[model samples]
Target: MRLICPNCGAQYEVPEDVIPQDGRDVQCSNCGDTWFQPSTQMMAEEAEARAATPPPATEAGSVDAAHTREDALQEPPQDAWPSAPEPEPAAAEEHWHEDPDAPAPGTPPAAPPEPEADPAPAKRRLDPEISRVLREEAMREEALRSGRDSLETQPELGLEDLPEDEAARRARQSEERVARMQGLDPAPQAHAAPLDRDRLDPQPGSRRGLLPNIEDVATNAPGETKPATPPPADAPAPPARKRGFSRGFLLVILLMALAILVYSNAAMIAESLPQADPYLSSYVAWVDQWRLWLDAQAQALAAE
Candidate 1:
């Protein structure tokens, strides 16, 4: 029987009897693939026919022949049964196939080839609007790097942009605004009425200080003498003289009175007030010394 390995495509020839009628496990010699080798109906029938055929006729048996016949007639020992033959080596280039209508025994159905993997979808393209925005941003950055001022790149902001009336009104307002701040009203003036020298003191050249008011002035007609103004009864009077003794006269009198009183009461005061004793004694000593000096002068004069 012909056999082929599905994995390595290695072909092999094996005897039919080697495989059992039911099925036998077989391994590929080249690829070592193991599969169940099921026998075909034809091979099973051939095996049965061979078994049914009678054994060849033998001549008169020798002792060894009779023993062999008896051994055959009796069931052969389990060890004596024929073992399955090894598979023959496969040729490299050779291959075999059975008729499609009469499929080979134990042949597995062919597997369909796997579908090829599809290429990864192309990366999604960027939206046009987004790409445009990115480009504009890049341009703006490049402009800044080149040191171009924003005012030059953008629209101008000037008076030219304003309406004529608005521009004129703004200019007038600016002119009205004083450049220098107004100083505080020349150092706040007093709330009282202004003073006039002529009105306050009507009479002139009179050194006597007085505040004669304008009501003192009299209006007279031509050829008529004006009546003299009567002096105000409430006018301020002269200051009275302060009566007091002169400083020199008062001092001299005070010294005389003190000396007379102190001498007259010296002994009595010293006895009654012990604190005054020292002062009184010192004063008495000074008077006595003076008297002695005067007596000595008088004596010298009399001698002269």
Candidate 2:
């Protein structure tokens, strides 16, 4: 029914059922100490045991009916009649034994009554500074929790700045969206008519898109009202400059003249360089040998 904090000696009254048989953890309001409080079941059992134990008889008159009958049988009172009617057999049998409820003659009386429990003290109010600090701490914790939850659930912001081309693409997408909402195309596509088969060249394939359309090739469609664009009068005819020989052609001509000059004066040229004489003679001998070999092969083929 009551609990006391060991640290602060503060008392608390709690219902019997509030504590289970296994005990419960309780915090002291005064000292803020937490401890396991024993269950009240054991206390309740002790109270029941005390209630079952009968009180001791203090006065002779206070003796039980069985004790009075026994005393009456053993010693008759002087004023009482000698021939008092005897109790009924059943009553006599019932009063034959001493009262089991009464204590023995030399036994002590019941235990002294327990002293009244003291009233629980009133809780002291917290200091103003402490209260303010606790309040601020609670507010800070709540704010931190809320901020953390928001950070977890809130989506991160993607790149807000975009390149010019990306911005243009997004603009186009928005325009297309607006157009779709209004039941219109954002970019209308041109539908080209099929060209007539008769106008296409016979040599070209019969496929529809194989040859270029006559209107497209001519740069103007028939029946168009726009006048033909005449050539600009200020544009002069292209000049007809005479063709000139490239450096490579002139180099080839020079090489040919050198070859002619060297051939006409071959002996003099070989005499001027002794190394040239051996090379020239070897080349002529090789050409003559090739000619003889070709003639012999021709004659052998004829004989065959």
Candidate 3:
């Protein structure tokens, strides 16, 4: 079956059953992002899994599946993701700093100052009035759902469990009145369109990948999974080696040189700052002043 990687738009495939069976983790071959998405069938299976389980089990399973699936689907592509439309610089790209990976000069990597850590989780918003309404609505909907569902299952329910006829009639009237004011219930849910994201990645020696953006780091994997985080801007980097002369080294050298120059200058200044004898000061001053005076006197005498 052909699958399109969401990242690179590359196409690839795997045996149909292996998809959910191997676990729904799919990634693009062109890039190395891994994400999970329940195929329509997988979703149905999930729903069935939910219905068949006990209430507590169903809740837990739903939460786990939801979390896993959410984490799984956000795969990055196989090839270079066109740099995130490079955020419009707060300043220009020139000031943006550069890296070897930079498309051109400017937009370089900021010096190895640590890249900011992963962003914190997004905050949830809750408004008091709105939250109150939502809570009430949720409670009402939950009651409606529970009431509707319990009607089918609980055998112990009695006539007393139901509303009084007059109250029921009044409630129906109020509901109808409110329904008329609001819109009608939404139409039945429609089938969602099928989406398949899978692609090719190049193996170390081979020209092809099992998938584009993701590959099985487990060579057995159709390919690797997408990175949990996007690869650092400096990723796909060559192996690490001992630092020879990084900026730190240059900075150390500069500091040493500055220290030497400062020390030398300080020594000279220190020697001068102490008061000198008047004779020495005068003698030095006379060398310059006396020579000029004598030359002037000779010139005047000669003129006379």
Candidate 4:
């Protein structure tokens, strides 16, 4: 039997029994078009019915028409006519026919197997020594908690059970331990003597002089004798020598005096000496400015 694709007019030579009597959906190998195809028996019956029907009347004088009809009748039936051999089914079409779910040709390849869902990450196992250490730490923590709870519930020592002095000593020791841990100095002992107010204040009979008496503070060693008589109060006191200015001081004073004289007469010097006029003029201007500043300072001070 011959089948023709309605969409692309591609023909396939299939077995007569390939299509059932009830008809079935068929797909085109060339165009991938699908449509319901009637059975060969039903198609033959339809053709026979079409042939039994009469043709419309025509003019009897039309000889060419009559001759064409006669020739068509004399010719073999369309089923007996030789047809061109069909090419072998393509690999893709054969595969598609074998497996309906197979993808069509020219489609993108299946999405790379969805990356296999990255497989659930395997659980990591801890080292044996690490696990042991962890367990030991947990047990130690549990024991510490238990011990702390018992300590919290235990009765405290009373004054009768522990002496006040001993308790104070223990508290001081604990405080010192904590201070040492924190890099601090421990407190001084309570037995240390406090500063005496009497010692800080002068005695009633003591003299209120700017300089203290050295004789009172001095102590004589054992077996040491005191001098029988003190030195006479004004027994020929040595003549006091006077201090004079040093040579450098005198030089500095002389230089200062010369500078003052030159500064005071700078304008007159510039007029008298033409060679030194420029230098003296600059010096005189500087001196005049200094004098004006000094005068302004003096006036401000007087006003204040």
**Best candidate according to lDDT:** 4
When summed lDDT is taken over every stretch of 10 residues in candidate 2, the lowest stretch is 189-198
- Which candidate ranks first by TM-score, i.e. highest? 1
Error of 3 at 160 (Å): 99
Q: Write the per-residue lDDT of candidate 3 for residues 231-253, one digit (tens) a residue.
A: 68966888889677697899999
Candidate number with the higher lDDT (2 or 3): 2
Q: After TM-score superposition, what is the CA distance of residue 109 in candidate 1 from its true location, in Å?
A: 99
Write model 1 residue lDDT over 1-304, tens digit each, in one string.
8887888989888887787778788899898889887887656688999999876555434656988888888985666678897766575225665567874689886788999999999999999999999999999999887776444555645634444343343333332332111222222321132222333224344423332222322222233346689989999998976656576788899998999789878999998999999999999889889889999999999999
Instruction: Please report, in order, the local distance difference test score of every candidate based on alpha carbons.
Output: 0.67, 0.70, 0.60, 0.72
Off by over 4 Å in 1: 1-237, 240-247, 298-304
Ranking the candidates on TM-score from highest down gives 1, 4, 2, 3
Model 3 sits at a Cα RMSD from the real structure of 61.9
For candidate 4, report its TM-score: 0.20
lDDT per residue (tens digit) for residues 133-215 in model 4: 99999999999999988875657445334433433444455545554544556665322333223332254344233223435
Better of 3 and 4 by lDDT: 4
Q: Once superposed on the true structure, which residue ranges of model 4 sit more than 4 Å away at CA?
A: 1-245
CA lDDT for candidate 1:
0.67
- Candidate 2 local lDDT, 1-304, one digit each (tens): 8899999999988888899998889999888999988787766787999999877666545667779788889985576556778768997687687879999999999998999999999999999999999999999999999998888565744432433343334434554555454556556511122223344335433434333354553443334447778999999999986556676788899997986676566678788998899877765567569779999999999999
Candidate 3 structure lDDT: 0.60
Please give the distance, in angstroms, between residue 74's alpha carbon in candidate 3 and its true position after superposition: 46
